[model samples]
Target: MSPTTLPDGATLRTARPGDEPGILHLIHALAVYEREPDAVENTTDALTRSLFGPDPQVFTHIVERGGEIVGIAMWFVTYSTWTGRHGIWLEDLFVDEAQRGRGYGRALIAALAALCVERDYSRLEWTVLDWNAPSIAFYRSLGAIPMDEWTTQRLTGTELETLAATADGGGRDV
Candidate 1:
């Protein structure tokens, strides 16, 4: 689809094949913003394959202003057994440091929200670090409530592999 114009004059659109570099740049920049610059292990080639491969698992939307990419939102859909509907899970949303405070972040979120409304997605959701006061405030201003009762747990690296291996033992609990 063609990029849509935002109130701020920035344009938002689904990322094209050549947007990997810009997407990776923002990914690393966001790592720095989250105080984990050294934790980013994703390469552009991996990102390219993940987003543009034959069976892409994720989608990204980018916002441009004056011909330069200023923000990006990478997301995927998740099914909720309780709601019996798919919801958009925003993995990351970031605006370049120089372009922040210009409503680019809000524009990116609004674009995703529009997609939710169009697709009958049950919800639009994402996680924010507790230490990120600015981001928390911004989300609150948009009427997003904190999921304080829920604790997020993740299994990755060796732990995930170990769990999968357990299936060989009849997948039984100890």
Candidate 2:
């Protein structure tokens, strides 16, 4: 996709080799905004490996203004058995608090939607904190509907380890 020029001369484009630090910063900011400031354990090295490494499965798009990254949309592909196609799972979307209301957030999401359309992806999806009213309203304004019938579930830490220990191959590497 071509780089997009934002209202204030900011450029929205895909993340590149030297973008890890900036992307990681936005990730930490996102964690803080989600009221989980201490939850982020991401490092630039990990991001570099995941986003720039050979066979990278994850991707990120960022907004840069005056050479500083001000927004990000980090995502990965997911397969839906029902649809028989791959879709984008937006893991994070964030714009600097000072840059909010400047259309950066919308631009980031719109870019993902454009990518979905371009690649014939079936969906672009993400979860928002239930109490984040402003974000909920923004998403709704963009015609996003909630999958209210579905409940997200997870098994982490000790539970995840316990479950893995029960695998048929005794959790041997595939």
* Each prediction's RMSD to truth: 1.4, 2.9
Give the per-residue lDDT digits (tens) of candidate 2, residues 70-131.
99999999988998988999999999998899899999999999998998999999999899
The candidate 1 region of ten consecutive residues with least summed lDDT is 165-174
lDDT of 1: 0.90
Pairs in steric clash, model 1: none
Q: Pairing residues by index, what is the TM-score of model 2?
A: 0.94
Question: In candidate 2, residue 12 scores what lDDT?
Answer: 99
TM-score for all models, in order of appearance:
0.94, 0.94
